[model samples]
Target: MGQQEWMTKDFYAILGVDKSADAQAIKKAYRKLARTYHPDHNAQNPQAEERFKEIGEAYAVLSDAEKRRQYDAIRAMAGGGARFSAGPGGPGGSGSFDDVFASMFGGATGRGGAGFGNGSFRFTSPGGSGGFEDVMSGLFGAGSRGGFGGFGQQPQRGGDLTSSTRLSFRQAIEGATLKLRVEGREMTVRVPAGVRDGQQLRLRGKGRQVPGGQPGDLLLTVEVAPHPVYSRSGEADLIADIPISIGEAVAGGSVEVPLLDGSSARIKIPAGTSSGMKLRLKGKGVRSSGKRRAGDLYARVRIVVPRKPSRDVTDAARRIDEAADFDPREGLTTQAGW
Candidate 1:
C-alpha cells in the first residue's frame, strides 16, 4: 500500500482487536476478516473486495512483531493519529504535510526551530521579538511549550545503544548468556537458545538516560565462532565427521561421539558398515524457536587403515584376497577408454 494508507489506517481497529493484542490474536482476526471479504467470496460486492485488500495491508504491517512495534511507535508520536495538510490553496501554505508542520513547529519557539534532526524535531527562537517562553507557548500551546525548561520537563525515551557479541560454535547451537560492557556499565543478557550467527538481540530499557522518559533498549549483534569438528546448515542441522578403525568398520560396535552440548553419546555402527557411510541421530542437532520440531545430527564415517600389520594379519589378508578373487577396478579400463 501507499504511504498515505500507512498514516491513515488504524490497523488494530480494522482487525477488531486491541492494540495490546499479541501476534496470534492479530493473525486470527486478520484471517477471519480476510476469508469473509476475499475477492472470490464477494465477487459481486466491490466494497467487500476493497475492504479485504485494506485488511490484508493492515495485517501485513501489524502482524509482524518488529514492524508492528515500529508502526506503534510512529503512531504514538503522531498522537494516536497522523495529521494531513490541506492540498494547494488550502488553509496552510502550498507544500507537503511534513513541510507545513516543519514551518509551523520548526523554529527556536519549538526547540531551536532549526528543523528535524535524525528522527526528532528541533525548534529555535524567532529573531528578537519575544522571549523563549512567549514563543514556545505560542507554538506548542500553553500546557507545554518548547524552551529549555519545557524541553527538560518533557519525557523523552533514552537513545538505543548498539553492541556486538561473539559465541562459540556450540554456544550458537545450544544458546548462551553474555555479560556485556556498555558505556562503562556491565550487564548480563540472556541469548536465546538456538540463536544463529549475525542475529540481533534487543534488551529493553538498557540504554542512555532520558529526562523524564523510560530508557531505550540495547541492540546486540551476535557473531558465532566456527567449530573445529562441526558445521551448521540452516538454523538446526549439524554435520560432522566420525573416524572408525578397520576392525570396527568390519566388526561393528558402539562408539562414543561428542555432541554440541559438550556431552557424549553412544552411536551404534552396523556390521560391515563401509567408509563414506552416513549415520543420523535424531533430535541431537540445533533447536529453533520458530519451528516446533528439533533437527538431527549427521555423522559421516571415515574408515582408517593401519600403517603396519602383524605377520598373522598379513597372512590372513592374503588368504582372504585369494579366496575372494575380487577385482575392484574390473570396469575402470573400459569406462576410462584405456
Candidate 2:
C-alpha cells in the first residue's frame, strides 16, 4: 500500500464515525454533516460548503466497500513505518512521514506516481510501482483506471456544482430557463422541458475553475412548487380536477379547462359523465426533449351542486326520484343475512 494524503484525510473522522460504521450509519452521518455544513444552511460561514464537499467526497469513497478498503490501506501505509528518509541527501533532511509523503505526492517534481493538489490526489504512475494504479486496473478496467489518475490524461472537467431551484408547477411542465446565482455570479441555465421535481439538470462547463483544465458543470436540483389547481403525475403528465355543473354532467357539453402552459382548451364532456370520471387530452401536458411528444393531460370530473336550490329544483328532484323504479343500491343487500 502506498501512502497518500487522501488516505490520511480520515473521512470517517470528518463525518464523525468509526471505521466499522455500516452503510446506513455512513449515510446518516453524511446527511447530518452535509446538512450542518451545507452552503444554503450556512451562508455566512465560508467554510461550511467546503466542509460539506469534503463530507460528500468522503462518503463517496467510504460508501463503497472496495474504495473504503483502498482508503483504509492508504491511511495505514501513510501512518506506518514509511518515514521520509532524505532521498540520498535530497533537498529535505530526515523528516516525519508527512514531509516525505507530501514531497512525493505533492507534484513538486511531477515525476509520475501520484500528485496531490487542488484538494484532490492524482496518480500518474511512471510505468511501474505496486500502487493503486495496478490494483484499480485489475479490479475494474481502463475506464475505472481513469478514476485512479491515468488514462485519458486529458485535463479533467471540473466537478459539478450543485444548487437547488424552485419552479412553479406550470413552469416545470412547460419548461423554463432559470437565472442561478452561484458564487455571486448569475448564470442563465435552461431547465429542460418536462423537468420533474427533484430532478437534476446538468449544465456542462459551468462550475469552479480548475488549474490548466476546463471548468466543471453546474448541477441544478429542481423543486417544483405545488399548484392549487394542478399536479404532476410523471415526467410528462399533468393532472387536474375539473368541476362540471349538474346539467353539463347529465346533458354533456364542451367545457374549458386550464392547461399547464396557462392556456385553456375545450373538452367535450360526454353525456352521463359521472363524478371521478377521468378524461385525457392528448398532447396537452408536459413535453420531453427526448420523446419530443407532449404527455396527455388528465382531467377528473367533479360534479358541482347548487349552493341554494329553488323550490322548482327541489320539486323536480323529488319527481325524478319518485319516477325512478330502479334502486341504486339494490344489489348491496344480502339475502336473509346468508
Candidate 3:
C-alpha cells in the first residue's frame, strides 16, 4: 500500500492487539483470527472474507520488522489514524498533512506547490532532493538516488524478493540445475554441490522491475530432504550404517560397502571387530570445494545375528556360549545402586 493509505490504517487495532504487543503475540492473534474468518472456512460470506483480508494485510505489515517500523512512524506522524485531504486542516484540524511534509522537506507552501490536485498530491523540495519520494525510499530501504516512481500514490520502486526451494538428498550432494517459480515467473537456478540445509543464496538484479533505477536482488534459500541410507555431518562428512554378519565380526575380512555414486568399495574389517565401531573411508563423501577439502565417509559397524536358527546351529551356539563363559553386563546392580 501507499504512504497515504498506510497513515489511515490502524493495523494494531485490526489485529486486536495492543501497540506494545510483541512479535509472537501479534503472530498468535493473526493466526487465531485468520482461522476464524478465512474464506475457505466461511465460503459465500463477504464480511468474513473482508475480515480475513484485513487480518492478512495487518500481519503482512506487522510481521516484517522494517515495514512495521515505517507503518508505525507514518501513523504517529498523522496523529494515530488521520485522514489526508486536499485542503488544510488534516485529521482533527491540526494542519494539512501536505503542509507538515512541506515544512519538513523545505518545500514551497500553498496551492500549485506541494498541494493536492486531481485527487493526488506532490512534494518537491529544492534541488529535487529530500522530497517525499526520497524519504519514502529511505523508509522502504531503497538505495540512494533510488526513489520510488509516482510518489502520488503510484507504483513503488522495486524491492528485494525472497524465495525458497527444496532439493533431494542426492541433489544436495551433487549439484543440479533447477527451474523455480519466483514472483510468478519461472527462472533457472544452479545449486552448487554439497549445499547444506537452510543455506541462503543471493542473486543480484533479479527482483521486481523498477521504473528508473536498477532492480533489486533475489534471496533464495535451499532446503535439503532427508536421506534414508546416508546422512551428513560436520562440513561435508557422510555417515552410514553398514551391517555385518556375526561371523564376519568375529573373523573380519574384506567386505564391499555401498557408496552414494551407485558403486561399491572393499574395505578391510579388523579382526575381532565389535558392533558400533566406525571405519573411515577417505575421499568417499562430498566433493572438494575452494573453502572446504573433500570429506570422508564413516561406516558404522552393526553385527547381525541369525534369527530362528536351525537345530544344529542352535546347539553349536549353546556350546560356544558355554565355552566362552562371558557376562556382557559385568557391573550388574553394583553400579549406580541399580
Candidate 4:
C-alpha cells in the first residue's frame, strides 16, 4: 500500500481492535475475522471474499512494527480537520506534507534551497533532493527506480508458487518424471527415488518472476499413496511379511517372495527357522544417493496354522508325538524363574 494510505485508513478500526491491542490479540482477531470471511468457507458469498482481502491488507500493515509506527505517527499528525496541501488554505496556508514532516522532526525549510540538518533526514532523488516525493518514495515504494524497494534497498525476488501432487507408492519408490501446468505453461519435474510421503521438492526459477529481478521457486509437495503388499522402513528399506506353513518352515525349503520391481525372489528358509524371524536380501530395496547407503529388503516369517485337519492326519500326528517325546516348553519354568 502507498504511504499516503496510512493517513486515511484506520487499520485498528478495520481489524476491529484497539490502538493498544497486543500483537497476539491483534493476530487472534485477524485470524477469527479472516476465517469467517475466507472464500473457502463462504464460497457462495462474494462480499465475504472481499472482506477477507481487506482484513488481510489491514493485518499486513499493522503486523509490521515499523509500518505500524509510521502509520500511527502520520494519523496523529495529518488527522482531524487538518491536511497538508500545496495551494492556499493548506493547513497554515501554502504548506506541504514536507513542511509538516520538517516541523515534526528538527529541521529547517525555506525558499533558500531548503537545507536539512540538525536531524537525520535525507532524500536522494534525481533532479529533486529534499522534497515530499523522495520522502514518500522512501516510506512507500519507489515509482520506477525501485527506490530502496521499500526504504531504499534494491529489488527482491517474487514469492514462490506452492502446489502439491499425488503419486503412487511405486512411483515414489522407483522415481518418475512428471509434467505439470503452471502459470499457463507446462513444466517438467523429476521425483527422486525413495522419496517419502509428504516430501517437498523445490523447482528453482520456475515460479513467479519479478520485473527486473530474479524469479522465485516452485515448491512442489508430494503425497504418496499407500501400497497393500509393500511397506517402507527408514529411507529406502522395503519390509514384507512372508507367510509360511509350519511344515515348510520345519523342512526348510525355498519359497517365492515378491519384489517391488515386478519380479519374485526365491528365498531359502534355514532349518529350525521360527515365526517372526527376519531374513535380509541385500540391495533389494530402495536406491541410494551421495553419502547414503543402499537399503535392504527385510522378509519376516509368519507361520500359518491349519484351521482343520483330517482324522488320518490327527492319527499320524499322535504317532509322531509319541515317538518324539520332546517337550518344547521344557525350560519355560526355569527361564521364568517361577
Task: Please give the range of 10 consecutive residues that has the lowest summed lDDT in model 3.
Answer: 146-155
Residue lDDT tens for model 4, 235-295: 8788889999866776788899998888989889987678989899998888844526668
lDDT of 3 by residue, 2-64 (tens): 344676689999999999999889877876786688565788897986776666667767877
RMSD of each: 18.4, 9.7, 8.9, 11.1
Candidate 1: misplaced stretches above 4 Å? 1-155, 290-292, 307-338
Q: List candidate 4 stretches off by more than 4 Å.
A: 1-145, 149-156, 182-185, 291-293, 306-338
List residue ranges in candidate 3 displaced over 4 A. 1-133, 139-141, 144-157, 332-337
lDDT of 1 at 128: 28
Q: Deviation in angstroms for 59 in model 4?
A: 19
TM-scores of the models, in the order given: 0.50, 0.59, 0.60, 0.53
lDDT of 2 by residue, 1-338 (tens): 11234645888898899989998798677666765776877889988877866666676567667768756755664566543222321343233333434544453432233333433333433553335433333332222223343443434334445566678877777678778777677888888777876555667877766577667666665667788888877767778899999779877999999865557989999998889898999888777777868788899899998799999988876786687555766756575464
Task: Return whichever of 2 and 4 wins on TM-score.
Answer: 2
Clash count, one per candidate:
15, 0, 0, 2
Model 1, residue 314: C-alpha shift (Å): 6.5
